[model samples]
Target: MRTALAAGTAWLLATGLTAAGAAPAQAAPLQAAPAADAAPLLDAGSADGRRFRATGRLVGGGGTTCSATVVHAGGRPDPAAKALVLSNGHCADDTMGTNDVVTDKAAPEGWTFTPAFFHDNVAEQKTFTMERVLYATMKDIDVSLLRLNATYGDLAKLDVTPKTLADRRPAPGTALRAVHAPSDGIEDGRRHLRQSRCTATAAVPALHEHTWLWKDATRTDCLGISGGSSGGAVTTAGDTGRLVGMLNTIATPGYLGCGLGRPCEGSAEGLVVPKDDTAYVTPVDAVASCLTGSGFDLRRTGCRLDRGTQVTVTPDGRQTRSTTPDGPARWDVRITPGQGTRPTWVAVKSGPFGAVDCTRPEGYGTPRRLPAAGLEHTAVLPAQDNLHVLCVAGGPDATLQGAAWAASLAHPAYAYVRVDNTPPTVAPRIDAQHFGEGDDATYWVRPVYAPWELTGYQVKYGPRAGTDCADPAGYRPYLNIPASLKASQGPWTYCAIGSDNAGNTTAPAAFTVPSG
Candidate 1:
């Protein structure tokens, strides 16, 4: 997760790819609950305060993630060749085996990811520049870079000139801005936190105490920045259009969207920061590392390197089918290299899904959706040395069909779920919610299960009780949750929407609630 840093102009935050942070209170040493019975390990709105960023996957089982832009040490600008890719170094545990091919011409899902993008590829991509792991001592500074040998692709195409360390140290209190990359599942950019100052420091890992320059706690928002979004940039736009550092990371959620569960709120929520006990990266030269060599002069032309880009290649799927979501669906297997990540949505909706080229604005085209046959299934595509492997589906059950998928941004080819169900994750259950006299309210739920049962959940609300639980009709059920409770006209009479994964669904269990 990204955190406070020495960079100015309200630095941005990064996803996970580093050390661990203050461990949350032990899960009360949980005991096994019924097969599918459980509650939310956390509330729908409390996860944001943990001082971490979303890794775009189910972390600790499930969470939300965002992205930032990152550049190499030395490089020139040319969109055709190189630029920064807002992704993670070792995604989902960096399991990229040689069997997982990073097609120089054909990528897994019709995209080309080079050695520069791999975690081990660090040796190759980092050649032109120096590499130094940021210690937890430098919390909010978990950033790294790859000095490029050439420039092309997005950076050159967009002529995006990044701001240097000096340009960013804003006049204290100057409105610092937060930035985000919607490439992963995020669709908007309103995710800016605040330009903060490193107030004090102690013997902590990669973090530094900061005098956060925020308007108020109510205005702060955060997501767990996990795997895929490794070395990204978190800066603000200067009148000149250059960017600077805000925060970087070492790790994010273990899985994509952390099960797409609603983010946590309240005390569990904390500002994002660098991994634990790591060193700080406040040296101006180090900050300059993200740019070009000092003598190279950035004002003229930007870095001279193309770090990473999406390459298209046909997939190895042999089967094709047709059908629809609401009714019967249809699908054709041209599994060849198609453009875009996050293809799940577009493909699931129609045939193809939305992908990202980051080099441009149009984003990407929709490709075929996954889960070819089964539901709630996950695949493990390792790209360590370009290794590939195939697994067998054990059985066909509801959980199997409607479950989670584990993928790696570095690998992009493999995704699977926890086949073994010994440590079952508990589904979330809403015991009861208390609405006080005025505006505050509290709801109780379960926690994460052993076999990754229920990571957390989704909440909805409305004036009517029996409205669509999965997709609430009105704003009643969600009136109490963080993002949804923005428009509460009265007090704590917030209704319950829906909860899943981490605990048993309340909509299925609770027969009724007081309708507001």
Candidate 2:
């Protein structure tokens, strides 16, 4: 999960910050620092809290919070320039698609950051508005480089310092510490910076979490990490610690399989789910080469990050395309090439539903090469059953083969097609209720039972029985009828058809009024 620290009434009550009927105060704007008297104080015993004055609580446009840090490429930077803040890409925009890459975009309104966000000195914190998103992407990495409206000189006046980005990835077993402003477990309900002592466990070649697949991630045993910890600074342990990575996610407990909160490590052998309490960090070394004196420039010499346009694989017609066993089990999809993208290779792989790894080439057959630049190209998946995933990857050399082809592929576009001939076996049941009497009598019918795989149901009602129950065009969506419908519509006959995730539907089950 991206760890969107939620702020709600329940959290206020749990923290005893608000009384039963008292209204919470509205958050102040980030134009200036809050009054010292108006801020909450923290424990004075801990001295380590003062070290991470650059780390702060980042509030998204949607009101959710995450951790972020002020960072500079290296040595001395111009203090007059607008400061740069680093955080997870999802923090900048959680709605980013699998291959979405956002660059040089205007920051959403209401986005702010509070530096010097220590539990001990909450009163000293200053909020600043985000001016722009220099670069933000979740492709092969989860990172965002944001520019603040305030200048480094402005922050320096308040004794706020920026952490230096480490030039390389930290080796396994390196002593490390994580500093973050997490919202969970805070008795006061305030987002306060917390620190954890840990060590780098291992390097994950690829970490698969839901639709995002991150490469070269560092796994750690960091404790005290929770909601609002996304983009927390993971640095080498010391007084002058340098930033090595940023906390991205944790292995959430209770998830039985790999997905979302439960990020699985992928390798040639397959995926491995880590035990609960495990956390992962994305290395920041790649960002170093991209940073310039002004800000980030993707065209920089040594920057290996993908700056090419995104490839799109869209189905010809309906977004959801399905086929039955007896029907032609093939789909026609259009591969649209983005401007500036290189020649692309398209391939299709199929497996049991939800088993295919769209990022890997282990099970993929051969790939068909597409021209360097084209408006669109059509690719057909070889006839197969189960689920098919069509992937399109771009690279430098169009004729690259074998390992070179797999290695050169970057930020591939994917589309899915599901094939299943089995229709839902179970029938649907309806519950009917009557209210009032005689002329004022009203009847309401609701579906009470549906198959486990049911996605939705089509229902039709009239004075007579329905004909051609399988015709979905004749029915409306299955919704609870209002009690206002007159029961005098008497002897009404209702028919229901259910559709499953595989696009297969069950035969209509009918119920007659008064007789049902």
Candidate 3:
């Protein structure tokens, strides 16, 4: 299982600071690192730590914490230039769905980045506020670029200099060192800069985890990666190493299949889960072209990144919603091309649930040419039972010439639709003795169903014996029996309905509670 490194409560507990600055223990401990290759803590006063002072802890709204580093696109900029910080897109916003891109948005209030963050010198660390989100996306890659309110001149006063971005990804077997502030299982050392020395292994052409897909990820055996290590700087190993990539995720132990916490490598054949524990880094070189001496400019001639497209599907395509099995389902799709984009062709494809390879072209139908002025169309997907995935992609014309055109086709703007028609079965078990006794006797009903097959269960109760099984109204999300009805005398009838991802509901199952 390859899991993202964004930390939740582990970040709070490890740092002993809440969003409100209260010290409280709430989240579970983070996954433990392998004992043989545990990363060593880097002292802030050490020469190497000072050399990489730009690497720091990033704190976002809603208790989200990850590692990030200040970076410059070209040569050192004028000291007055606003600094840029890079991290994983999910680290910036965990709610970001597949193929979603966010740009030029105001930064969340109170979001801060602390450089020179050594666990031993927590009080001395300087925190800078984020000003704006320059670019963020989880489409072909997981990355986010943020602008800081502070300028390079401001950081220079603290003896902190931004790392220079490499023009390209490092070759395989290249010596690498990851500098990050992990707050998971480190106890008192949480937030301290840790260094992991390793070598790049292979480049994954396509990597899939949960709903998001990433491309050209570099796999390495870097140890000590866990919650809060995301967006850490992965640099060439040296006293003056340059930034090559950022830590994105790691192969989690004890998980059997490829999913969340278990990223799988995708190829034409299928998905393959790595057998060993390792960490993956997303390249940052593509971002260099989008930057200039002034700042980020998505319209730059050589920029290959998506300018930010809008793909909306009626009835909500982002999540699984129910529809009639084997029945025609019409989808109204609207795609607004990003600024400066020349999207000439759009295509859609469907495949078995969780089996679609967005990177391949074999399954996609004929491409539809977009009008010069508008990009709106209605698409009808093939009817099927159970669950299926529908993917949409847009790119430049295939006949175009130039590297930029080729790059656009190689990394197109894409979105996914999870359609499900299957309804889950529920078996309700009642516990009579454990709750209460006599008139105050409480009944605890446990609805047992396959979690992968169902989204949730709904329940309703009444004194009447016969209730319509197909009625969709009046049922509430399943919880314990209501306290007001707990002491009711006569027999009570309870009905439970199971709902799946597609909003399809099963027939209600009835249960009777005998009078005491």
Candidate 4:
């Protein structure tokens, strides 16, 4: 279903004006040749900009069309699985349920992917049929990872190399470039695939925590992610072409064929009051987690087996207990010598106690390892009952640290655990009850700060009559928060729920808007 939104409220808002630096040459508009005509974007910047080609257009039997990208995920040395296809879950399959899809779980009939679909050069393009579905879902994350029947050699002629999947998640303000096929709807008839430079605007305001909105680099025009652009690869702006997310949906129409603040081209109904320059994007990390969890071996670029490094956790001291039963349990932890600088803090995962969630706590500071000495560290476990120490270690970052735990040694040389059944810490309060003016009305809710990782949140609002605000499916699926809502001259009740990365949602925090 189309993401729910308040009537007459314009949710699509472009936040950037300058093109993302280092993005591939400006994308050729549909039907229009690129100005530079630089070397084709071949092999993910392997052979200069002239030879870069990793994006493709996907067409299905039921008239469902979108874009696709070839990604490298497994067997880094030789790439166990070289050409895994990544796209939006809704592109291949249209079935969407309350939490997920229903049936007929394969790519729709006649579904095919054409890589290097540049300049409409039919002979130079290579087409591949989807062979298997590695992992796909629409409920929580709108991503689909699939295996194609074509080999690396098939794409090699098109000068296409599998793009690398980013290991990290994206935050607001992250610069991005969407390499996509803006079909007739999104584009103004330009034929070739285009690269629209944009930046992530928010993580969880209108839609789910996993879905984010991005503003186009151009201030005057919309990002214009139309039908054919669905499932296109959205990569970082640098030369690596590392996959960060994929085009899911336009979500809302920003303008009715008119530039921002200008007269309507056709009808005023097409305008999103504030003019939405954003599109819905499903993150690559979510796709990777789902694909890997489903027994697929996706290869990652520059991550060969021999080159992979294991982090070593060295315990500074034996576990120490508090004299009082309800006090904090503590142990010191430090990465082994020669590894590098000391990690700010140790991430712990206890089976009996619970998982250490850190999704929402982006940029939040970690408690120092030592009470006095910053160099020496300590693993502080919450004082509770039935908590068993599972694993602890350090890595490049918090997200990577969690990934490192998977490869950690069982009963590692040094590790500690403690119990604290307290639900995740709630935020100080809802950031705001209202934002924007008139048609641009918005509601703001900051993420609840906590030591644990936070995954996402649920937002609900409606007349106080008989609304079941607790039901996520019942709540409006507005991801473009603050911007997607309009202020009304009425007393409307709203609620915000916080969730840890582990999917633990907080009790509803409610507020009401006073009638104007």
Candidate 5:
């Protein structure tokens, strides 16, 4: 349940203005810091010449982490197939299923890293251990991809697919911008942000080389890059935007360890890699050449190394798309032809406080309500049917009480049928059915894009067994979907219910409990 928006952390990738006389830029905008101001990253910028800068939080209060530009060896972002792109595997590993303990023994070729929480924040900077496998799978070839997790706060949203990373690498020396939630007092408790030049490419393609990598600032006011600042990006300056590598570890590693709810260290250490840090880019090309027994031109997809499938979306007249393994979280959308000048298209799931994750079950991003009480939002099938609407009643035939429902263990159940115009675009017709797909399942909730006045969802289910197939009582209803029946057992009765924002009356959308 990651978000589509990484908020301001990774937002720096947005294209910028480089006109000859571009107006003077203001410092990064930041929130009021906790009274201890400037005490955290107290003396980071002392050393000069370092690149990269950023600030970010862990998902669901994961923890604070920072990001910086790769100046020395990784000065700017590079889309060059030559460099490797590294990260903690779990950054986008939700497809492996939740709570899945991480292990590197199963590391494969294409798996990118995860939210750098455990890796950067662990007690003693753990090397790949049996008990402490890196999250997600790892693709070593690139020297800078390894990472440790850290905790700061929750993340906005992110796009983590092979396709997403494929062409995102910028040409070497591109104007790279970085930011992250600084754990130190670098920028008065606020994020320490910075813009810098990506220097050059790494000499080795091995992922382990990352262990020997270190930072030496040759410039000033560079304190923006501080602790927990791993897994960020280094890009180039231009009309076209790209992603070179993420802000790996930051500034310096501290033995003091322990951050957020985990054991961590190196309050300052930035780490990352070339965009294409995989198991084998060149040799694999030869392998592909040998596999086909012919010179294989596999880079056609534009990625130095193909990672996974790509997912596309036509958002608000834009053709931006996402390509991830677990079926595109579909976020991380960028405008082509013209970069940063346009807005990043997103499904706008939930508002500010309601993000899509376990801890913030409140919803995605922020919380939105039906203008009135007792209404449920939903979407229709087929992308063309975007008439997202709200329900003020139960079954289409149910009374007009405007009963709504917020029934779930995570959220409180409320039932107020006041009829309002605020609700989720009726759950996007449950596509990828991660759960069972039986008749009892609600195939799709249908996103109710625009708001409308209503009572609740029109859920119908049930057909009693052993009763006359044609009898009215045999036709019970449920909010749940129907299941395929065994032999021709008389007409199955189902339940019909209505849901609104406050709560929905559960009368139908149900099936008979199978007997032993």
Candidate 6:
């Protein structure tokens, strides 16, 4: 059977099968049912929020439970180099006991995972079975990596677009989000993802924290985490969406409220003093370190060192304004190596026009030596054209896919001048919304995007109130309320259009504003 341990400062080294000691009382399972009047949606519309549904239970004998998250490595979500689920090592114990893989203990029989079960909006929970565990260990790190079964073809089709792993250490004071599905009871586990907003308190925590890339964090709000959340994800707050760490355990002064079958909403009374009483995480680098030596071929190829490298390009001066076609724009490129590395190559992508070979002189390809450190290179680009620049630097031996490289790297920088000849796609969403003024009717119009082509928005309304619905004619400048803005009153049909600087127009987004 699974064991629990009290919250303490003593380290539990992942070196061997230490005898199962007294475990902490299992926290109450999370309350998974939302109020009957609650919205039908389970997520908050954020990337990680939507992806939380993919977190599921690791079911062992007698219905023991733990949590795990699905991840797709590399920047791109689809067609990734590695896709795997990660969780605590104890979740896959072969004997249904707290066993360590470093001690040569295999995972218990019937060890399996089911994604998106319980609270999946149906009368009953439905789950898709995951395949075998590729790696599991308690020694030095409490982690388990599992592969999805072959029967589930195409992870993308399964609606399991994995999240990209975080590569860099988050700056202190950065806000973060952690999501998990905690077990509610020994009889039945909680099936919905619970989230807590936390702040990074420290970069290197104490040894008992049980991770090399340890980051001590505390919930910013009253969101308490409970049991069964082991192996869930911890991510940053911005749209860049870097995955920072994995949930391990909590160190609370006392039992927080919202336990077993209760909403894991943290309470002020439950908040403890003492620094040790908080949540702990295993950094994402641990996963990379483990997978690289596992011989599973899961090690991500391309430039690992290059992923953290920073690149920046700036216009020489006064170049921010729109320019006439075929205008000249001058810019400078700067490259800064991430952490312990430096640049090796720089390539420029001049949109809709010129091509420069990276290997040749002034290019980033090999045989061309990089300039001295802290030096800036200047380039003159055409006006009204989009430009993309890449700067790569690493040891001479680093290579990717037969391309000689000491490491892989990200695009250095991209600049746009907003010249478009093609019409923009129509905005897909337009809705009449209510914001409780009782007598004010408002409509929100979304934008149709093709990256940097948008220049202006126009809204056309009919002559009479409440009748100008969805028509293409009689359009006027919609300077009053911007897209997603709310207006006081409207009983009129409205159609919205977008334009690009290059004289291209988008199809309309139309809706009839109901009389408030």
TM-score per model over all chains: 0.27, 0.65, 0.69, 0.43, 0.23, 0.41
Largest TM-score belongs to which candidate?
3
For model 1, give the 10-residue run with minimal summed lDDT. Answer: 210-219
Please identify model 3 stretches exceeding 4 Å from their true place: 1-3, 9-30, 33-37, 238-240, 310-345, 349-411, 417-516
Residues 65-181, candidate 2, lDDT per residue (tens digit)? Answer: 888988877635689999999999888877665567788889989999988787666566679999999898877788999999999888898777788888788789988878876
Backbone clash total, candidate 4:
39
**Model 2: colliding residue pairs:** none
Q: Which one wins by lDDT: 4 or 5?
A: 4
Which stretches of model 2 miss by more than 4 angstroms? 1-47, 238-240, 268-270, 315-333, 340-391, 395-516
lDDT of 3 by residue, 1-516 (tens): 113688773442232221123322222233575342467788878877887888898988676889898888664878999999989888888666666788899999989998877766777778999999889988778899999999999988887888877878878898898888776666755557888888899887677766676778998989887778899899888635578999998766543334455577764344566764678999988888788887788889988776655333222443344344545554545655545565777666755433566546666667677655556554665445423445555566544345544454455554434444545544433333335677776654444333223335687766645555456677788543332346355366666776554566777777666534
Q: Over the full model, what C-alpha lDDT does candidate 6 score relative to the true structure?
A: 0.42
Q: Which ten residues in a row have the lowest lDDT in candidate 2?
A: 25-34
In terms of lDDT, the best-performing candidate is 3
Model 6 segments more than 4 A misplaced:
1-41, 44-48, 75-83, 94-108, 117-120, 123-126, 151-154, 185-190, 209-222, 252-277, 289-516
Q: What lDDT does each candidate get?
A: 0.25, 0.64, 0.67, 0.44, 0.23, 0.42
Return whichever of 2 and 4 wins on TM-score.
Answer: 2
- Model 4 TM-score, 2 decimals: 0.43
For residues 217-304, could you state the per-residue lDDT of candidate 1 as single tens digits?
Answer: 1111123222223233333323213333333322122221121111111111221333222212122232453344332322224321
**What are the RMSD figures for all models against the true structure?**
20.2, 9.9, 7.5, 17.4, 25.7, 21.9
Q: Model 5 scores what on Cα lDDT?
A: 0.23
From the highest lDDT down, the ranking of the candidates is 3, 2, 4, 6, 1, 5
